[model samples]
Target: MTYMVLLAASFGYVFLKAWQQRNVAFDHVWWVLPTSYAMAVVEVIVVTKIVMTGGNWLAVFVLGTGGGFGALTAMWFHKTFLTRRE
Candidate 1:
């Protein structure tokens, strides 16, 4: 549905952008932004849905914190692994 389409489009955009900047060593990092944005959007949707269903704010806060940490960890790992060495 909409989620699937959004996922596909996000990944497609990442792939295209990466391909377009294939010559640059760190260009792939650009892909991470779109992926992160997509995930953030999904997280917001899930949180809103949960709130609408009368879920606790504590649960939403925990999920949001976890998601943010995961995204930061991913970005760190990507930078560590993909960046060119001196």
Candidate 2:
């Protein structure tokens, strides 16, 4: 459950940050800073867990799975909430 939540947050923030950068000229989105910070925190937890578990293949595989889930979550959020016709 913890992994699922953190994975979703991490991926959502990454997608938000990338979108902010790609769609702007010199403007800044205040929300992106906090999202980036959250992603950093979640990644630290994930990395520490993976490393403390001896960096085995299964651990790495689970990490990858978490990341993939994160990406999917981000994509879904972007499509459902962020996209706008312009």
Candidate 3:
């Protein structure tokens, strides 16, 4: 259960942080600071869990899967919601 939640949260926040980065690049500061802080918090917890689990293979795989999905989601989200089309 814990791992499941963490898996979902890991990808969710990574997506958020990536989206925030794109926003920041375009001078969008409103959400950047908070997202940065949130990302830091999430990373700490995730890394701690991985280390504490003795680098479990399942955990590592989940983390990598989350990251890959997060990156792709971020790109899709930004293009779908943030980009201004001419």
Task: For each candidate in turn, give its C-alpha RMSD to the true structure in angstroms.
Answer: 8.7, 4.0, 2.0
Better of 1 and 3 by TM-score: 3
TM-scores, each model vs. reference: 0.39, 0.65, 0.77
Best-to-worst TM-score order: 3, 2, 1
lDDT of 2: 0.57
Q: lDDT per prediction? A: 0.50, 0.57, 0.78
Question: How much is the lDDT of residue 70 in candidate 2?
Answer: 57
Per-residue lDDT of 2-86 in model 1, one digit per residue for the tens? 3333334344334433433432455665665565566566556654555554656554454445445544554556556666688
The alpha-carbon lDDT assigned to residue 71 of candidate 3 equals 76
Q: Write the per-residue lDDT of candidate 2 for residues 1-86, one digit (tens) a residue.
A: 54554455445545555544533433435556776676677667766665566767766566666557656665666556656646
**lDDT, model 1:** 0.50
Show model 3 residue runs off by greater than 4 Å.
Answer: none
Provide the global lDDT of candidate 3 against the true structure: 0.78
Model 2 bad stretches (over 4 Å):
1-28
lDDT of 1 at 84: 69
Better of 1 and 2 by TM-score: 2
